[model samples]
Target: MESALLLAPKLVSNPSREFRSNVRQFQSSFCGKSIAIVEFTRTDAYTNHKSISKITSLFSLGKKKVKTIKRETVIPDPDYRIPIVLLGFAGGLVYGDNLLAAAPVGLLGLLLLFQTTRVKFVFDDEALEVKVGEELDESGENVFVGGKNRWKYSSFVNWELWWPNFPILVYFKETQTKPEGQIHFFPVIFNGKQLYDVMVERAGPSKTSGPN
Candidate 1:
C-alpha cells in the first residue's frame, strides 16, 4: 500500500521533483496526530485517496490513560550525536559550487555537535542500556545501561524512529511509576503495550510487576 502511494505520483504524470509536494499534501492530516498510534492494516482503496489514505492513525487512548504516561525528557550532552550523522546524511553543501565548498565548516560543525550528543537508550535481546554520550566502550561506563527489568527480551517490541532534528519528544521517566524511576529528556525509541504483548511471546517469563 505504501509503495503504491509513493508510485502514484509517477502514475499521475508528475515528475520526481514534485514527489515532495505530493507527499506533503498527503501528510497534511496525519501530521497533526499527536500521541496517535500508527499501524498498517489492509488498505481501503476507495476511502484512501489522499495519497496516504491506507495507513491508519489511532488516537484511541483517553486523557487519563495518556496522562499516566508522563515522564521527564532530557539528554546528556546531545551535541556528540551530531558529528556521526553529518558524516552520513549530507546532501548539498558538500557538492555545491566551489564558492560554497569553501564555506566555513564552523556552521556544519556546530550543527553536528548538536546531533551526535544525547542520552543513549538501547534495548536488545540482552540488556537495556542508558547513559550520557555513546558508550562505545561498554566496559567502564557509568550507569549506561539499566539492568533487566521484569520486561522480556523481544524484538517485537519495536520502537518509533524520529527525524532527530525535529524529534518526537517523549517525556517519560524510566519506570515512570516503577521502582527504578528516573527522569529523562532525550531522543529514544519506545513501543507501547500492544508491542509489549508481542515481546512477551518471544522473551519468555521476563514479565515482572509494574505499579500501573
Candidate 2:
C-alpha cells in the first residue's frame, strides 16, 4: 500500500511540473515582446524630438536680422566766425567813438556768440533739423510765421550760400512752411564747409557755387 501511494504522487508531480514550465515559457515570451515594443516607442519619440529641434533651429537661422541706425549730427563742432566778425565790427565802432551804435552791435555780437554755443545742426537720413545744447534738445516752434524747425529736403525750392569763399549767410526757400514757399535766412554760424556740403548732398546742388 505504501509503494502504491508513492507511485501515485510521482505521476501527479510530473504533470504539475510540465504545466508550470509551459506557463513560464509563455510569460517570458510575452515579457520580451512588451519590452521590444516599449523600446521602439521610446526610440521613435526621441527621433521625432530631435527632428523638431533641428527644424526649429533652421527656421531661426533663416530669419533676417534687423539693423539699428543712429541719428547723425552734421555740426559736431560749432564755428564762431559770424559772432567774431560782429564783435570785431563792434570794437571798431567803439574805437570810432560811436557809443550808441557800438552798444547795440556789441549786444548783438554777444547774443550771436551765445547762440553759437547752444545751437546744433543735426542731420538724419531724410531731413535737416535744428537741435540745441549738448543734449540735442528740441528747438521748439519756428520764429517764422508757419512751420516747425524741422524741414524736409523734398520741400526745398532753392537754396544758396553767399560768397562761397567766405560764406557769411545761408538762404533757402521751402514750401513746407507755406505753399507759396517761404524764404528763410540764417547766418553761417556753424562750419561753413560742412554745412555747404551737407546742404548740397541733401537739398541738391544750388544755382550758387559752394565754398572751395
Cα lDDT of model 1 by residue, 160-207, tens digit: 223324443323234422455543333322223322333233334332
At residue 2, what lDDT does model 1 achieve?
A: 100
Worst 10 residues of 2 by lDDT: 50-59
Best candidate per lDDT, number?
2
Model 2 spans > 4 angstroms off: 1-73, 208-212
Encode model 2's per-residue lDDT on 1-212: one tens digit a residue.
99999888775665323211111111224323311111111113333332111111111222466798854556636889888988999999999999889998899899989999998888777788888999999999897664568888899888998868888788888888889887888877888888889888889999644322
Task: Find the candidate with the highest TM-score and give its number.
Answer: 2
Clashes of 2: 0
Worst 10 contiguous positions by lDDT, candidate 1: 17-26
- At residue 185, give the lDDT of candidate 2: 81
